[model samples]
Target: MVDGAIAGAVGSAALNVVSYLDVAVRARPTSSTPEETVGRLAGLAHVDLGPEDRAANRRSGLGAVLGYAVGIGAGAVLGALAGTRRMPLAVGTALLGGATMATTDASLAVLRISDPRTWRRSDWMADLVPHLAYGMAAAATLNRLRPPSARCG
Candidate 1:
């Protein structure tokens, strides 16, 4: 249990680091109309998007935390069910997470929030690597450190 908990914490921290890096990367100026690009980046990074119906895709910080809690809970449950076979369970969780992420991002688009498709190279580079690292590290830790409760089945 301690190991599982540790892994979860490490994974969450890693993901948050990725999140910050993604924010920083998107803040850089580009070759496009600098003003418009900056404005869009600013809007994407720190807009009150939840208030406007057209851009109500923004989830509160607490809401995002709750979402992560849900994800962790789901992962823990799945890991327990799958027992020591942590790889498969983690992969399942990652797949599930990816689906959830895509759906959330799509909702953001529907609400006129940030469009990842238009993300600059830095944005993609910063975001992708960290998330991948997060997934892999999380999976490795959870799978490798199977909790006692998970050892039964």
Candidate 2:
């Protein structure tokens, strides 16, 4: 149970680190204008937007991190309670984390705050890597707590 809790915490930490990396990458200058950079990042992350949206994406990204913290907390509690049934906890937590990000990004878009339309492939590529890394870490960490009966080995 202790191990499961630790693993869950580690998984959440991994997600946080990856998210931070994504932010750092986006902070770097690209061909994108300042106004477009935020919106472009939101688009790359699959968040929809409109002219009336005024939410600050960078701040929302911070909120995404907070949401990840909640997901991790939930996962750790579930993992500890479920013991050998960690796989579901892990998968659920991972999905929750993703959903949190999508929600946060979308909310910001609703307020009209976004990146420039000229977001480059390189910028998006940099962002993609961190998200993938975070997902992998989350999966691996949660796998440790999965029951033998789970589909995963």
Candidate 3:
């Protein structure tokens, strides 16, 4: 559990770094999907967040925080699973990336917030690259932490 938590933190940091770098390089606006998803969920749950102006800002902040939480949580879960039976580095990385992407994309689709099918090639690349980085970092960290005996197939 401790190893997983540590790996998750590292993975979350990697994801954040990649995201910031992408923004710096492209000067692109951050995606609003998170905020929109959060808002939709809130509405469904009938959870009032107070004043309209404050609520909007709060939701946006919460959305970003939630994204980080998901990344960390996913890493932890993956780490725990890998502890029992380790996967090859490449396979683990790909699975982690896919898992992370699916979590976000699934939530958006379920809430009718965004359709990935409509995304431009550039948008897809933007989302994919950082996630791949996150997966690699998390998987590598977990792999390194595993006992040598456990690492072998």
Higher lDDT: candidate 2 or 3?
3
- lDDT of residue 130 for candidate 3: 84
Please give, for residues 59-86, the per-residue lDDT of candidate 1 as tens digits: 3334445445644653455455555654
- The better candidate by TM-score, 1 or 3, is 3
- Models 1 onward score TM values of 0.50, 0.44, 0.90
Q: lDDT for each of the candidates? A: 0.52, 0.52, 0.82
Give the poorly placed runs of model 3, Cα more than 4 Å off: 84-86
- CA error at residue 17 for candidate 3, angstroms: 1.3
Q: Write the per-residue lDDT of candidate 2 for residues 47-132, one digit (tens) a residue.
A: 76544444555534545555455446545665565556545544655553564345434544555554424448875555445444
| Higher-scoring candidate on TM-score, 1 or 2 | 1
- Cα deviation at 42, candidate 3, in Å, is 1.1
lDDT of candidate 3 over 1-153, digit per residue (tens)? 567667667777888799889998999888888789778988999998779999989899989888888888888888777764556878877988889988888888788998888989998888888888888888888877887678646
TM-score of 1: 0.50
Tell me, by TM-score, which candidate is best: 3
